[model samples]
Target: MVLAELGFDAGQILAGLKPWVECESPTYDAAAVDRMMDLATYDLVAAGATIERIPGRMGFGGSVRATFPHKSAGEPGILISGHLDTVHPVGTLDVLPWRIDGNKCFGPGVMDMKAGNYLAIEAVRKLALAGHETPLPVTVLFTPDEEVGTPSTRELIEMEARKNKYVLVPEPASADGGAVTGRYAIARFHLKAKGKPSHASWALEDGRSAIAAMARKILQIEALTTPDCTFSVGVVKGGQWVNCVSSLCEAEVLSMAKRQADLDDGVERMLALSEEAGGVVFEVTQSVTRPVWEPSSETLAMYDLARDVAKEIGFDLTHGSAGGGSDGNFTGAMGIPTLDSIGVRGHGLHTLDEHIYIDSLVERAQLMAGMLMRLA
Candidate 1:
């Protein structure tokens, strides 16, 4: 029934996702991101959502929270949370414009989240248009900085999640078409080293290379990695010239663990590596920390509902954990029942080939609407 409602609206759904993809809301580009927010706000307002705009001050595009009126007022509502940022840069669409050929629709940001974000609107819009108002309230959250680990939107996501009965994150479907049931704990560290600079050819003996110390630290830190928990160096910068021994070096380290104790232990071990360098300035400090989101009976129960919904829509559904993090992490950490990856079926996320299965558009929308009806 839900699919038949949305079957005629497939083109409309793709049309909705195109504007957001073309807006090119990279997290670093504040103005571009704001455009995406504006577009979403306009659509939500037209859908009868009461809009609350939160200005982003930490050099971000800010956030938008829209609340749709519920039929009854006895229970907490639902929060559908996602972000507008993409890993692709501004000119990505110039090369990989949105197009549908066979089963695929290719474009940047379409798979990672823009498609998912727009699909939520389509879900609620379908319900409203069908004259099916939910007794349980509904809310949607669009943030600007989720692609870069949600630095600006964590608190807002948590605040909204704590007040809601459930959080549904519209990320992409898993590689095997499963929903994300849990996510690893994530933490970031910045390492820096400083030493005297000298000409490599003329004063080689007088120079103490920060690069050398950094290399040692990188190797030692990487050796501590395991299958479940691991440390990775994402960014590194240090030398001035090929002929000179550089005086400064810095690196961004990312660590993930299944448990809090393991994450804490990993940080302590990495910090101990700073003592390896006596002559140079070796320092390790943590920058951001997102606690682990493990599955609970509550989340598992939500997945059971999702699984039944997917089956009704003619698909087999599975659930698992992801190494990466999402806004769901904030809500799940607060012990709110959370479910993720209910977007269109697609893969190659965060890449130029990012796309969604064209046929899954209606199916996912119907599934979302069905879940809303059943839960409400």
Candidate 2:
């Protein structure tokens, strides 16, 4: 019945999602992200939620923590968590314009989670309009920096999860149409090299090649990849002048593992590497680290409950482990019950082609509404 209700008024949901998708709240843009926050506050207020604006003094973007009181209280509450920031930079909308083509609705941050965030708001709005009351309290936290590894809101997410019974994260649904239960532990490093510089024509023998060292180190790092652990080199920069040997070079490495032991070992081995290539030295700095989210008994039980919910709506339910980390990773890693990828189905995340299924706009909201009612 709720599903039908959502489907009937899908246009309203799109009205709410349009501004959010077009705002282009890239993680590094504080003013733009705050504008996005203001827009979210408008929706939460309309849904009868008490809004708390956590200022982005961290120089990123402010976070919104909205509370919807329950008619009857028993547990702490449900922590509905997500991030508003997208990987797309400013002016991306110019290239990746939002449009609707059949079942597909194309936009910048639609599927990666702008649409998912609004699904919760629509759910609550529907419940309110229908005179439905929640069985337990609900807190929605939309932070500003998930695309950039949640640098500003990591502790806030952890602390907020401590107050809730379970964390439901609406990132994107898995490629196989399953919710994500497990997420790989992730780490990032910036490796730099320093070497002697000399003229290309006159002092070739006296010069040291930092670029050569970076290339050699990259080869060694690639060897660290395995079935359990993986490493990726994302960016490379070197050489100030063409005629002189490069004195400095830098590269970024992204590593992931399913288990902490493997992560520890891999990170240790990667950091331990300090080999010389063409008489240059390499140094590595750990920039970001998010622990793996291994499923707990309570989490598995929640998944079972979700499966039942999906079945009741005539859809098959499934789940899988994810390679990317989310805010759920921080909570689930702490042994808290967390459900991820409970959002709309679409593709091309972090790219210009990011989008959500037009039909899922209503379906997911209805499903989440059912979840809130049943789980509570």
Candidate 3:
């Protein structure tokens, strides 16, 4: 294929990826994420793409839509999906500054997605520069709130994907150096406890401690974890004074299940805990959710295409279902023939030590370019 011979420049690719890692776009900070989106807009427009900026809703940053020029312009083609937001906060750069040590390049969000998004953009740009149009039209959609389960932009993602023939997500490559063909069901919940407050020492019998109720409930939630379904109370906040019974407490729960039915049962049991227990009222509310996306035959065919492309690029590619949820969860669930996690290979995701293998930049770009050229 013409794209396989494009020969992406690794130095130039790193140059393009550095500023993005330095930008530090956390999911909760709309302005920081917008800055990242602005950078993407500039790059995509420069690559001869038509740009559309969708304003952020629900207190999240806006998303970018870039459509590459092609003869089959508006027909069903490829939808390349990604997220610009990272779990790292804005000031993370001060701690985990961008650096290159040997074959590894270290920075916040470098591997989790910045490098992946940049690689896809670079592949498209190289094809454009070489005066070769893709076999099918291409549209790249970068959202700003994926780390928080794509709460703000799920509707937009599904709408754009429906108009396309296939969906490709450049989330970080799987741990086993493979791509994602399917994703597990994921659900997040918020729990609250309300109790009467009183002096700890003087009126112990009169007090109803919200923290005590939440502690017991936390144990209950954790005990529900099975091989098929697992639960975790990751965040908790409660208490006012050391000598007084706590009046209120709140916790965030995350659940992951291999199947939709397992997740549904888990959700049902979680909701059952909303009743009053031990004189304290508990509330369970479902937050952001991602439905299960099992691999279909069409998705398997897409993976076969990717594997063939990888073989031509001098590497064997593998595919499997992953636990962590991504925008692919939304697209694949729609039966859109989605191929996901076709991005840079790296480790330490969602941590300070996050980084990518510098060599994978060009290799993955070539793989992506091949897929773009070969996909009809």
Candidate 4:
């Protein structure tokens, strides 16, 4: 389906994008995140969206929701999700200046999400400029602290997702620029072990070492993995010094399972192991950060819409499943038709080399605008 050509001012959009990149809104820095939210609020309002700011817990950045109300049919809106926070801390912006070289723009949070946020803004702007009234209302949910598991905004995301027919997530496209159709479910857990401390040289046999117990548990968890299910112990902390027996140790484990049942099974096994270890008191706390984005008829239809939009723009788009998780995972788990990886393609997300293709700024914006026009 051919929608009206988007009236995109690429230069102006880029001009708005630069300052956003310069604002270093890290996850834990509430003040910096508030500044980024203010910029987004201003831009969205200028583009005719009604903005709402949701305060987050202390020490964490808050979230913003912008609604572009459609005057046509007044149906349940489409939800566009993106994060405004980066993985970097407050001082990162000074160290990592935003720079452009050839076709790529590099800086903190560029590829990971800030670029995606800009694309969403530009899409809404183009639609407004083109005078395409959506049949359904459209809402853009921009959250800070997604990099830290979205604890504060998870309920908000779920509530908005349930009210919408479709959810579009602007996470950066895969390395090949294909859309991600599915993502694995993630359950993050922290395992803490407590034991009696003693002098290592004299009473080693009399005392129980939590660190030794943790090492054994780590190896056991690693052996429980397969191709479909994966587990990793990312962070470990314990031991006061080399001379004394450790009394406490904690390890953070990330578990990925294809299905919820698999996740349950994995957790059960872990709990069993924790119980089996002698002389060690174990505590396990699990959080379901993102559920798996399984394939469904609704998801396929969403992909069809994206493919149609891509074809209209003289490009063919492909879809793939991924192991990484996003808020899209939550929407997909809710049984909504969710299309992810709808943003610019680049490299080094969550790393110092993060960058976005400069050309994708225009192309992906057009694609998003076209899809919204047709779908709405």
C-alpha lDDT score of every prediction, in listed order:
0.85, 0.86, 0.93, 0.83
Candidate 1 per-residue lDDT over residues 7-49, each given as its tens digit: 4377888888787788888999998999999999998987788
Quickly count the clashes in candidate 4.
Answer: 0
lDDT of 4 by residue, 1-376 (tens): 2443675655676688889988888888889999999999999998898888898774677888888766643357789999898888766767677888898888888888888889888888877777767667789999887876787888899898998888989999988888988888788888998988999998888788999988988998889898767889988999988888999999898888878778778877766765635788887778656777787897888888899888877778899888768898888888888899989889988878888888777778877887676665
Query: In model 3, where is the ten-residue run with the lowest total lDDT?
Result: 1-10
Let me know the TM-score candidate 3 reaches against the reference structure: 0.97
C-alpha TM-scores of all predictions: 0.94, 0.93, 0.97, 0.90
TM-score: which is higher, 1 or 2?
A: 1
| Runs in model 3 lying further than 4 Å from the true structure | 2-4, 201-205
Question: Distance (Å) between predicted and true CA of 92, model 3?
Answer: 1.4
Per-residue lDDT of model 2, residues 1-376, tens digit only: 4456544366787777888898888888999999999999999999898999998966898999998867644358889998998888899999998888888888888888998899988888888787777777889999998887887889999999998888899888888778999899999888999999999778988899888888888998998899889999988999989999888999999899989899998899888986565578789888879998989989998899988888877687699788888988899999989999888888899888888888776667767888787775
RMSD of each: 2.0, 2.1, 1.3, 2.6
Q: Estimate, for each residue in 271-345, the C-alpha lDDT of model 3 and write its tens digit.
A: 888988678999999998899999999999999999988988889889999999999999999999999999999
**Best-to-worst lDDT order:** 3, 2, 1, 4
What lDDT score goes with residue 30 in model 3? 96
Model 1 stretches with alpha carbons more than 4 Å out: 1-3, 6-8, 73-75, 276-278
| Comparing 3 and 4 on TM-score, the stronger one | 3
